[model samples]
Target chain A: MNAVLHLAAASRVHGEGATEVHALRGVTFRAHPGELVAVMGPSGSGKSTLLTLAGGLDAPTAGSVWIEGTDLATLDHAGRARMRRTSVGYVFQDFNLIPALTAAENVALPRELDGEKGKVARRLALTALEEVGIPDLADRFPDEMSGGQQQRVAIARAIVGERRLILADEPTGALDTDTGEEILRLLRARCDAGAAGVMVTHEARHAAWADRVVFLRDGVVVDETGADEPEALLVEESGR
Target chain B: MSIRQAMLAILEQGPMYGYQLRAEFEQRTGETWPLNIGQVYTTLTRLERDGMVEVVESAAEDGSDRTHVSYRATESGRSEVSEWFATPVPRTQPPRDELAIKLAIAVTLPGVDVATIIQRQRSATMTSLQDYTRLKRTGRAANPEAPEDLAWSLVLDSLVFDAEAEVRWLDHCEARLRRAAADRPAASAHATPTATPETSDGVAR
Candidate 1:
């Protein structure tokens, strides 16, 4: 199957010889349609770096990133930006919604910037808002809603216009327990609807919603668990 | 800890023979703790001796020349079930969890790659977590209001929570081990593995 997001042996380095920092090294990853992959790692484990590279926000110093069979390295800056707008969606920890815009407007902003007409963009935004289960809040501004509702608006923005790849960095970091879980449920539902998703999270409970988990350590892929591996008992039952 | 009490608890609501009792118990726990009919009968025999349950035999009502036997909780058994529910499960003594013990000893052994052990275990646990989550995804999404479905889901949720906690603890252990190594990369190399590694909470780095 073609991957919606793929990073092949991608590596990123910063600074000179004396103080070089390898944010990621030889990390290969993929997320196919109908799958959500969670990246789990401690601080400075290159999780955010991986997300940036996959989103084409940062270019890898080595290897390549492919989004929906298109090698990002082959695309120029304008091309990459267009790809980000058309195919990729990013949700950040802080629920990055423009304060001045209403919920529908915030969601419509991306599609509008992508050259979509106002009527088409607003319709798409309303559909996305409905998909995230908050259509009634479309007219409410970011400040008019709670954190969870604001995050829902942010997600509606990311998922508007049939975006194929969703990349979320700590998508639930700012919400409370129940609200965070509700957000994860929305992500899981999106993936189930055939959009590939890659989420970077420190919380294992949030990662449990993913179809697979990739664990990073020291800028390297230390371990990965495919959702299909079916032989082992839950660890608590291992001794029994 | 006795299957007898669980059987009694179920029987408290209605009567069941040995196999029926086993099935009922399995249904409630999603078969997480399966019991053989023999074990069920053994526990039943003991419960009968203690006067906690009484068996009723009915003559062949269908004229098939077969007798049916079922046990119902006695008054004493009802009291016992109530007491069991009233009391909290004890946690003074932790269960013998092999993974925790393995890490405990692995960290002490000289020349042992504790990080590898932790990493492998984490991977395995995550796989199990995935399996459980998949089961949850498929098994849910329909008939959620059914009692049996709710029972199964609750059991799966427990396993998911346990596995996630284990992963977090593994991450925490890795962090501790890294700090320990960085603190004494030189001295710890030649020192005896049995030597106690200082774990100061005050160490900032």
Candidate 2:
């Protein structure tokens, strides 16, 4: 499969001089089409930094990030914003849906903002909601729905249209066990359906849903292994 | 499950020979715990001796049928099975967890990187948790409503929950260590400046 998201030696540093903190350091990562790559690390380990950079929400201090063969560094601010809207879908730990909007409306907002007609965007939103197994919930507001339902809506919003790259950060943080499993199943299904996905999660069980796992520590890629070889991760970590 | 009870329980349904009992037990429990035929027969012999089960027949004189012996649960065995079902599994005496013991020792031992041990164990547990979830998914997909399938799924969920709890406990341990370390300097300043004897009451990080 072609690489849908790529970060070549990407680095992100916050502040300058004595206050400077390196969030990511020369981390080269990639998520290919139909693959879900999970990033696992402790707090301050730059898992979120890598996700934000991959989603084009943050720029790398050095190196480059490419989505679908297009380097993010090459895009202007307006172009990058358009790219985020049209190609990259992001799911935060919080649902991040506007309370005033119903599930369908929240999902449709992105497409509508991308200049798609309201009717077309709504139709696409309903389809995406159906894809996430909650078409009936499209009319429910965020407060009216359960956390799991809201997250399904969040996923619906992320996956609406032809957005081929989905980035999720602790998407199951607030969910119960069964609900979390359901969310992982949805994300896994999306990847199986051909969207490249990168998720930042502190829990290893959450990372297990990915096809592969990337371990980050102290702002660098510490280890990378297939999901089946998780024990190998510890072996590799011991070497470090 | 105890082998003696399992045998008696299978016989509770009806009279079954040793091999038949073994097959039925394996079938009902989804074969997650394989019981050897020899163990089944041995348990049955003990059950019969204990009056929990009685052998109905050894064999007929006919040359064609001489190898099989049937057994049925006696009143005592029926009561035993019922009691087993009534009582919950004991939790007062918890099973020893190797990871827990290892962590306990690692925390007290000097020069051991307890953090690394916890992290490694967390990774291993997470792998097991993932394997359980995947098994559950595949098992359900193959046999959605089978009682056997549900039993195995419940078993897998138990493993997942246990592993998750271990990871959480490991994180808690690390956090507690950090907090204790952070409080040490403040704690030292409050101690008497003179050559006071060390107190065993001082909290160990």
Highest DockQ, which number? 1
**Candidate 2 C-alpha error for residue A177, in Å:** 3.4
Model 1 — TM-score against the truth?
A: 0.91
Computed on alpha carbons, the lDDT of every model, listed in order, comes to 0.84, 0.79
Worst 10 residues of 1 chain A by lDDT: A231-240
Question: Chain A structural similarity (TM-score) per candidate?
Answer: 0.95, 0.94
Mind giving the per-residue lDDT tens digits that candidate 2 earns over B59-127? 654766765679999999999999988888899998988877887776666656665565566656666
Off by over 4 Å in 2: A203-205, A223-225, A229-240, B27-32, B57-67, B141-143, B177-205
User: Lowest summed-lDDT stretch of 10 residues in model 2 chain A?
Assistant: A231-240
Screening candidate 1 with a backbone cut-off below 3 angstroms (N, C-alpha, C), the clashing residue pairs are none
Q: For candidate 1, write residues B1-205 as lDDT tens digits.
A: 7566778888887777888788777655655676878889999999999999999986655989798888889999999999988988899999899999998888777887677777778888887777776666655422357675687678888888999999999989988877777778676663222122221112221
DockQ of 2: 0.13
Candidate 1 ranges beyond 4 A from true positions = A229-240, B58-63, B140-143, B188-205
Tens digits of per-residue lDDT, candidate 2, A100-197, equal 99999999999999999999999999999999999999899999999999999999999999799999999999999779979999999999999999
